[model samples]
Target: MSLAFLADYANSDDDSSEHKDIIGGNNISRSEDSNGGQGYCSDKEDVGHGKGWWRGLVCLVIGQNSQLQELASACMDRLCTGTGGAQAAVKPRYVRVLGDLHISLTRPFYLQRHQLSEFARELESSVGGMGPIAVGFGGLSTYTNEQQTRGFVAVDVDHGKESIRRVLDRVNLVVKKFGKRRFYRSPRFHASLLAVKLAGDREMSEIWGSGLANEQERIAQLVAVRIDTVECMLGASKYSVALDRTD
Candidate 1:
């Protein structure tokens, strides 16, 4: 599936120093609060609870350097703006459109510290010799969740499909020990580009059916992405494990 439960990352001024500003040109204000008292917590507190954390494996696509990533982000802006309708006109909560536009490789799952460490070790051994994954943009599609409709720009990974399969196999082996389910049977690989709360669904539907449908092909072919490392998100932190560059 596509991603983004942590999109509005780094909301407070103190935490602002920990994050950088990128596409969409704004720092995501903390949806919670600085102290995290009844609000938000510092990074230390976020992970201290142990149970509140989960891990997600993903390949990075958008960041500070890519020209195409910049373009894709602009497209997101349009999709968000175009979704406004007769509803109360709430402002769209645009994700911080910078830093690693990614596609989830593993469903975010819970794991104890030792379990996560063992998984990391296994992952490192599995692909240390493999090179970068070649991927191409493949148009866009819409997905509906209980509260929102999200727009995903499909990604066509050259040799990475098989890698995704292999990785999932290993991941499922460990995750099952925790009684957690695995990845979607046939996960559509894509980068989540935009999200609109359900209130805007009617409007998003119209835009998707007409104006957007015609543009998918052109937009998808706009660029290619090469991913060289798999990143993991646990709690509020992110860490990377490199993939060897054989190509």
Candidate 2:
């Protein structure tokens, strides 16, 4: 229950102008303002189709400004190199570990960003038992017409593939109870920093228009992250949970 998803957000590029350089354009800088954690999401841009409950997980950053730097470093370390986007768009929340991951008991009447603080508290009180932590991630190449979201996060990990497998197995238990109508799709773990509505009944469209599904699949395969702490959000404020005491 202490699970929270980590968002890799806009690579080194926050502007998002150059499509070709989209690989790692997010700019996350790190500093003394540091904290770390483990966190969720399914494939098909894990954030897909969960707007009613999706409160988004926070990013694990060392510093608010330096958050982008950490992301860049992580990408470069694992990916070798990447990206291009508007430099200014990157912010402490957008470029770093901004919010927590917890489902909202209340749903917004209209399309709007749901607050995360209260839900985070709920997670701490409820699911704080699961631990050791595992995290997985991948970026979007494109989002299909039906996909409601793009992006992935996996957390509360330590063991490796086995650790991830264990969590997924448990998550599947919760997922099985819910019908597709609530999800209207498979359960995917994801984070949303910026969501845009489709203009004038046109329908929402992904900026990349790329293969987000495939991208998420690839990241999950490649990563099985380890974690120590996590954040939860609900009612707009943020909350934290420690993994050390995880059962």
Candidate 3:
């Protein structure tokens, strides 16, 4: 029915640089767990403003700790408002917005801007020789689209998933360009906070399995993302591949 425009620019914000608010906005401070409440919001980097030239290679989901990012951004803003507002053709799709969460780890497809500074200096020397990388977020998953249903939160590359498939095979061998694709032979890493379009197709999966079953059981206890640096959105503006932690 509606895949929300195949992902409405896949979390547009012009590639967000950090406009704040991804959970708790800024006055973040909540305590009291044991399922009582509080477990989300851990933001500090968000930027957006779309322009066009879509690019990819993501990795931003650091240490959730704002009551599970304010209960996964309020359960993806109540499943993007259950799409009852009726899908518009070019706008009014605001179920909620703020940083738009992420954790792609490569799969975006598109490059140009003069080949993006030698593919961002060979992807920052191949992620600084592959160092710091310990992602995890176990639980919750979905990817349907007969009408829409893109909820995500399952990324636990325990053994570092072959070091992120060798940094997505060296970013498809230094981004040759021309709509690249290679990156998902079996890669299932995710972090997308939410997305809904179905109104009858199981009504947003029964409202995300009973309204996010107790915040997905306290977020399936397993949150930890630390991969140094590698943002790159390109087009709306945003590129990074920093790596020098050495710790």
Candidate 4:
């Protein structure tokens, strides 16, 4: 989880003239729009039908901020250009940048319409009193989904790990009561910065080694994040629970 290699790669020029900007016009602002439609209710008719189940996820959302947005833009640019085969391997449509960042407190699950109110109420009661947490980025890292269909580049949480874990513990309790799966037993808390669908079994590291190992300290200093609210997404609906702000 280091970013030292980026320094060298950032300066190298691509020899291929045909190399298109994988990022292209889809820069910072556009990237945010890419995720806008997801996890949101589109049809008015889908609002409240207690007969059906809704797909759900609980997480600590990283709201839009200038600093993190800049870092994410930089990470996306360098990773796509610097990595040898990344530009060609990357599916631009799948890329996710700053605005979509969040740390999952529970795995995606299902909630029946009748259970939504109780679930949200219990979750709020459990974590509402917790104080806001200041979290820092450790460095860059990579992960593949359970099905190994897609790959992700993310920033690991360097500080405030325990506080996040405490919140996760509470979230899991609520999830368990609803008969949903809890999060990982050993979680590596991170905010996914970029996502891609590679052509084959090509590992992201094959595109480039994790990140700039030598530049970790500098990167950590460049990014500072805060978590004060936890959001639960059910279908297109959202429920936000604010943390205690009192010092």
Best by lDDT: 4
- When 1 and 2 are scored with TM-score, the better candidate is 1
For model 2, what is the error of residue 216's alpha carbon versus the real structure, in angstroms, after optimal superposition? 9.5
In the range 1-247, model 3's lDDT, one tens digit per residue, is 1002122112322122343221221111111222111011111121111443334444443423464457555555555554422122212253333233545555454555576455555555555445556665656554443225432322233446666666666665655443465544565655544444344344434544544344545666645656655555443434445443443
- Per-residue lDDT tens digits for candidate 2, residues 1-247, read 0111112231110111111211111211111111111123322233323555432433232112233224333422222111222111112232223233322111111112433333334334433445655544454221122332322222222234354344444333333332211222222333232222223333222222222232343344444445544432222223444444532
TM-score of 3: 0.29
- Candidate 4 lDDT, tens digit per residue, 1-247? 1000110000100111121222211110011112221432222333333558765667786766666567666656656665522434344454555354577677656678778667777787777758788888878777665445455666778889998999989998999988887877888887765555545687667654645463455576655677888866655445667775432
Deviation from native of the Cα of residue 144 in model 4, angstroms = 1.1
Residue 118, candidate 2: Cα error in Å is: 10
By lDDT: ranked, best first:
4, 1, 3, 2
Steric clash pairs (candidate 1):
11-30, 36-40, 62-100, 62-101
Off by over 4 Å in 2: 1-122, 138-185, 204-207, 211-224
Worst 10 residues of 1 by lDDT: 23-32
Q: Give the alpha carbon lDDT tens digit for every residue of 1-247 in model 1.
A: 1442222221111121233212121211111113332111112343334564444343442333355455546555555555422112325463334334556666545556655545555555554445566666655555444233333333334335775566556556655655766667776665654444435545444444443455555565565556766654444434455555432
Alpha carbon lDDT at 55, candidate 1: 42
lDDT of each: 0.44, 0.29, 0.42, 0.58
